[model samples]
Target: MTRTFRGRVSRLTAAALLGTTLLLPSSAGAAAPFPYQDPALPVATRVADLMSRMTLDEKLGQMTQAERGSVTAADLTAYRLGSVLSGGGSAPNPNTATGWADMYDGFQRAALATPLGIPMIYGVDAVHGHNNVVGATIFPHNIGLGATRDPVLVEQIGRAVAEEVSGTGVDWDFAPCLCVARNDRWGRTYESFGETPDIASSLTTIVTGLQGPALGGPASVLATAKHYLGDGGTTGGDDQGDTQLSEAELRAIHLPPFQAAIQRGVGSVMVSYSSWNGVKLHGHQYLVTGLLKGELGFSGFVVSDWNGIDQIDGQSGFTAAEVSAAVNAGVDMVMVPTAWKNFLTLLRAEVGNGHIPLSRIDDANRRILTKKFELGLFERPLTDRAWTPTVGGAAHRALARQAVAKSQVLLKNAGGVLPLARDNNKIFVAGKNADDIGHQSGGWTVSWQGGSGNLTPGTTILQGIRAAAGPTTTVTYNQRGTGIDGTYRAAIAVVGETPYAEGQGDRTGSMSLDRDDLRTIATLRKAGVPVIVVLVSGRPLDIAAELPGWNALLAAWLPGTEGGGVADVLFGVVPPTGKTPMTWGTSVTQQPINTGDGKTPLFPQGFGLTY
Candidate 1:
């Protein structure tokens, strides 16, 4: 029995007699039109109307962002959660593009089923391509991209990454870590574009690539400028350490990149876990609200780093006081992860006690809902499956290869030892990174810390060398450099750090090559063959003492997935054009060295050799 509203005729007269209204509200309530549901209303008008109708619980939910593992669909609907995120390595059982889409859709359905029908946004650390997904193209980390000095190429990579992310139903990317790294020993050095603010500023083109000219465009995703002010300038290069800089120094070194990001219309800013002097950024109202939102004219919402609120009082876990402080400080979205329920309870109590203002709560919801409206989530909130096939397509891989080639900085090529003949010769490839895709990709890969050896599908440098070799040439690989002999023309020792991220990767002591790498190079040196050292590292390693021993050297800064690009420069298919984005210090003691700092470096910034 179908009953029609408006001008349409109803087949079920009996149902009509029951006085049920269909499309429009009955004549009694006709004077009050639902402006929020009307597509013709301006976005601002719609947002206001929707806010006017939301309850306190719904508004609080809109301010919260829960991790997927801790929350279920039932939880989302019951609490009206506004967002969900898959932490690094958090994926569906299958972990395929379709599997992700299904998971996202299920959560989204639950979110929409709430009384207000607000769609929940999903975020992931897709910092370097759709990194969490298997079979997705992995581009070089920011340090490698910075070496390329190609903003246009970076924008293209951003667009490709956005497409892949959209295909999987994720709407937000916690990316473009705009921290201007001041020290190489920082575990997150690879996340930064370079040490200087100029590099990070110039690369803001990635913002436009991710968001397009406007929000809600096809394939557009929310972009986040992260670890706001002084995170990269921490004392002693410690992860989540304090930055003991004056206001002027902080503005000079770390603030410019975020200013550039704001100008690019980036949708969100992430608060840093690190502190300035002694004040934690999560609770710093002056910076989060007064500076970024007020002085910088940023209209976007601010998100807290993963469980960042817990560290406000240097505590192991978060307290009600911490929650109140963070919310009052203008963190619109709280990434509580596992403790989201506790966060909600604390926040509600705070608000009820007037420790947190209703005005602040409304402001947070307004900022978050505005972006959701701009994203057109109400109109189209599901995964755009059409883009799924582009995840690890050949074209993206080709672009990655090109980026890798451009990122290779040839530090030394003494006596023209490179461009090794491809035919009628034998090449020896040795060291841990020579044949491992994961080793070259570095951290923030499929998993948070990443792993070694064929962790994902990609071309290894050894495979590229063999593919580029002529029919008469042979390529042999021995990870430990044990099989090298005088018969080999040259020994390519690809050695460097394994995968690590954040606090786990911070090195407070020696920053030089490991003993195993030195031994491997020594083994190749014993063979009496020309030794070419390729360093696959996140930052500059202390290798000045070993420089004179190698015939040639290439700084391949975490060239992800496409190892063929490294081979291209090695075989002369492409000229070395990348420059060192960070100054290579002569020793570990010169930790904070930079260009124009008066101290001599092992290699200056922008220094690279040609073929």
Candidate 2:
């Protein structure tokens, strides 16, 4: 009889067991009445249960995301803030992976200590590897990856980046910028995959790589498909300017990538700061709700860009009206960085007044909590320190090297100057970018608008050249190309734009080679060595006049950290496979040149050379 009874009890369903267990005292000697605490329940059921128990304050808190510097751990608990983030360049005092983990754990601790014990999510702009943490592997920016035209490679890079991020306890990444960059003059052009929606749409494989097969798996992160609806087609190639394209053009040029990302089950969609047809995206109900959520079937929460709501009324600061509009428009999460307190106050007041409906509040909380539950935040909220060592690991760096090699576009290999013989040749390397790791990595490195000179650990182009050279080869370096002589078989002048991001990088004037770069090439030319120009830039430069003088030209579009990849193609270790992701304009005047566009470019889209 005892054996038969035990057998029957063992066969009970998990829900039945959990139901039976809830009747008894929990380990903490308290009643576990909430069904949300049970891991076996469906995410939607758990979200509903949790939302039912939450107060107005708690619901609003889940929708607020404050920057790390703006709020303390104690404040996180006091306000029941749902999320925290680190802006570019923002880091802990130690600025190590461990430090970041500790920081994240502290905030999470505060969040869990709240009445209901909901864990808070932390986000960062880990666009290129775990960029905020020093010593983290910095992969080449999106422009470089776009040039590769290899979705599989880009996806692998995303997985590696997710691993590093998970090691540091950051669960959310504002990455894989899906904008179809229409104009090279846009300062944020490098953030785009290519000029066409196809390139960006193809690269949506990164969404799978980031989140993995499922959300709760190890190395899984919440991938964001960002800058929704026509940020890339702005007039005058402006950063936050209006995109005056017709609805058809917007859907054709910018919507496909987002559709692909949605199909891949992207966890979040961030609204763009830019406007569409003289309307701010942050307050655009049609795009955010009617289009992205309704038509696209995107169940994931929509998040506002950093302080994006402030610009809805062309204002300097956000107001109650802005909050109402943004929330009503379906921005489930607000990145109120520094103004979170004010935002919360306004949001609460607005909700109380029925300006922002309680249904919308519940909807936002439901969406946010669903992700938190799916992330296994309740079961495992702290950092997965086991992944810590993967940061800057040899395997990841090797992968980065491969990506860099694949991204190298040989624009002009005149007289087969490239595939340079590794042995018995004197090589002279010169220019600002040749030996500078920071410059090679480009913006969104350790800091916001990444700085130059050994800011982080990585092989410089000169270092790679020397390492790849044979025993008999001698490689000499001079930043200004002053030491080159006629005896050298070839001179490599690696010069281009220094690090800048967003509006600061905008080029309204001439996009010609700088005076310093021209001078460096002139110095090398005077020595009678065949000048090989390795342009380390984010976008195509106007080099039509200077192209005639250089023997070979390589567009090394911001190859981060692993400069050996650049050297790989240079010395024929790897073949040049990268095609021009953007149209190489004949002059700066042909600003919006694209593949099907009427303007004839210096190097058409898909142009590249091999050994």
Candidate 3:
């Protein structure tokens, strides 16, 4: 009787196996479902199960994120690090789409090789359309997009950014910077959408579009609302400056966009590199723990910006103990670009000694896991490989072209010299930016501060002018005032900030014009020629000091890669609709002005007088 009963059970088990095989797709033959989550089980139940099975080492590893090159595949298995990220401009072996994919796949494979087989999440800035990668569609900086005041367009841009980023297997974008820029002199002014809380909040819908549905859907790249809690309100409009604000002011000014982002289910919040009222954001338990997690009920994981944790002690050097302190302060992911071992060893020692609570570790891991699950990473272990067809494809370029065209604001069209004679006989294009890609791209392009001319293949303003001038327009280019002839129909002078970044571009409260630029503009003006000044800069220079010399002025605020786009509007192929997103103050004294300050900006925030 026992033999007969065993035989019957074996037969039934075989029948059930046959039914399961029939249920799955034939194309999905022999594929193993990701062990992290089973659709047959509830999401919460799956997360809990995964957490329960993880060892203490695994849990701690889940709470940390290491840079890509800091450790090899062997270290990933040994340490079982939960995430890996490419720091700014950190590319794969070749920096191509396939290169990014291969790098991501290799790292993920290593992490999954551990006993739990959990995949590591990869992240990049993708701040302006996967910008670190060569040939990716570089869009207008956030400030330019703010001028459109079109949240829908911003969302569309976000969607395109998501598609391109995810195409290369990246799952997170540190973007939709919700900074209400208080000073134009801030080098990172281009990164912020606007100076008002409303604009920041409204424009941040890009987060929703990028992340997609909370449950599960395509186009689901995790969005991070970054540099959290008063990054823009720093003293002297400083980069990483101290923001001394009343609690009410903090809540009213900086907290709204975070709140809005949270409501939209933003996947993560990167702690600011700056301090709030003398408290370092990376070490501020009151804000990171009490406010962000407790009061605001943010369930998303908190990440530290690049080397942000190290800056906590200010003058004091960062040690393992200090890193552990910042981790305990509520940073789920630490971007220790060069010191992964220090973070790992210190964190483990802290956990062992009870300096860091296991509950905190669990909470951090859980938050990250929830985001991964929300991203459907558990279900779709592999990204859609077919995204290659659309990565930096025509549609993205078309949108980038549109963004470029609209971002051109006609600051001045005096004597209607611009929309210059389309059939002009000669147009002299003078300045470093005439044939330069890096100068036009400004900060955060190919390199951190960007380079000058031909760093990448794109039409420079000179190229566009030449293309639009047809066969008759003679274009002359010179760097240091040598290539000038007596007469030309019009001279287009492209001048402004060369190439710089935060702290490097820090001014003592004035937009000092480059003396050489002034000489060039003045020289051209005195040559008995019509000179059109194209100011290419991150901040609005106090051009009133210099504008008296030029016949027409165009505020082309660092139009990226596509300098030809500027000529598109300049020669009347496209009309300039972009108004000044940030106020172009007449002078430094007229700054810090908003709509309600009872004093009008030299040009109101929405001011753009077009021809």
Candidate 4:
């Protein structure tokens, strides 16, 4: 049974978890506990008392979130910053589970040393299973999970992710990307569950999984609904580009998922870097304040995207005007990343000159502090090593494998070529993705734009096939599909796009399989064996012209860290049930295709063939 992580641990446990505080203030423990530090007080009462004790500088610091690389423990003590975050691929030296916990403890100690002793919060883009960690269980991306159409399974993945994240002392996750991906050409198509609001909204179960029915549980990590408002419906699938939809279209297409997230008690909402109709979301008061906070009744803090405030003025860098606009628009915490100091200085001036109001600052602080108290961060500010071993545990990996298998969409199994015979058969597996773990995991793995060639620990698809094959069965693999003379019973060509994320992943040009993949499959075809083309991709590729030549096709959308799941379906151990999360394009010209758009797709949304 799952443990309820929101139960606040004792102060002794928190101190033990924190270990020796090298930077504990010289006057530590001399004063009595403040009203805000009392565990029995109401959250509102505590937040109010904490606000009373804080100075103007401390109040400003509570709203600033700095990137880990740009700030240190000493800086936290001096600036009294409220939060810190590890950008994608950012980690401390040693970059292991213990290293992360130690780094977090160091920072917590500094924050505790301050006059008010307001514990700071740490955040990460743990979108796909604590991805920054080298050996964490990397679950299938949102598109793959979306294919499963199982909200229960998504919630389970969320719980596992929260456990892994908590083990590393990260309390916040910028995940459950509820963007209703309307265009396959968008680089972030995989981040969305499906091309419709229903799919994304259903997966809000992940919020419950992360938060564990309520906040401040044994392994709870606050979940975030990201890139708020129309990031997925961008013009030309352009990342951080203009979204030309009207208010009605926007409310219908993109707003439902956020509503679901809020209902699930999601602790944070990330402002999108993209614009709606022309106005950037980071500075949109009517939407952020009036719609999200006022109408939606969202009490959680609104965080800015990575340097998202900087783009509000359509400029190269953030300015005083941008700071004022974002705050005035109801942004509680500014994620300025490297330029946090500048943000603090400018924001302080903005408040002094009446450009930004005091009520807004207090409201933002109240929202931010309430969640911190609700999360029991004030009581347990350090890593509980008990959860550390769960980071890449066997159980989590098994769950990831299950998710991968469920996510596999059997697009084509013509002539009954699937469910390859397990015994007395010879299989030839070829393609760049078949043997590469990094290629299958795709972007947002250990790095920002995920790379190929043994990036982390995980079984490759070819490895899974070999492991799943019967003792009598023989499996052979070649990267380029060479040396085949019809001796094999079947040729499995795992081919698709290489690893990419966000900006680089957009398909403004042709969305066809790369030259290497085409050549590899073509080579396999010449051998006269039944060809099985498994697509390891972030989004549906334009494979209409090539579909006729292949005997079988499986849309394996970037199954992360586990390849055995692919073999589970291939060898008849698991039935294929996944459907297309996004409309599969026949050609690159159908860039913004969706359900009811009237454009003929190669495989319409929800199209999947089972044996």
Top lDDT hit? 4
What's the lDDT for candidate 3? 0.76
TM-score of 4: 0.96
Superior by TM-score: candidate 1 or candidate 4: 4
Per-model C-alpha lDDT, please?
0.88, 0.89, 0.76, 0.89
TM-score of each: 0.94, 0.95, 0.90, 0.96
RMSD of each: 5.5, 5.6, 7.0, 2.6
**In candidate 3, which residue pairs clash?**
436-453
**Displacement of the residue 277 alpha carbon in candidate 3, Å:** 1.0
* lDDT of candidate model 4 versus the reference: 0.89
lDDT of 2 by residue, 46-103 (tens): 7888888898899899999999999999999899999999999999989898899888
Candidate achieving the largest TM-score: 4
Which runs in model 2 stand beyond 4 Å of their true positions?
A: 1-32
Candidates in descending TM-score order: 4, 2, 1, 3
Clashes of 1: 0
lDDT of model 2, residue 20: 32
- Summing lDDT over every window of 10 consecutive residues in candidate 4, give the lowest-scoring window: 21-30
Which portions of model 3 miss their true places by more than 4 Å?
1-35, 214-216, 480-486, 589-595, 598-600
The Cα RMSD in angstroms, rounded to one decimal, for candidate 2 relative to the true structure is 5.6
Clashing pairs in 4: 5-217, 5-218, 5-219, 6-216, 6-217, 6-218, 7-217
In Å, residue 516's CA in model 3 sits off its true spot by 2.0
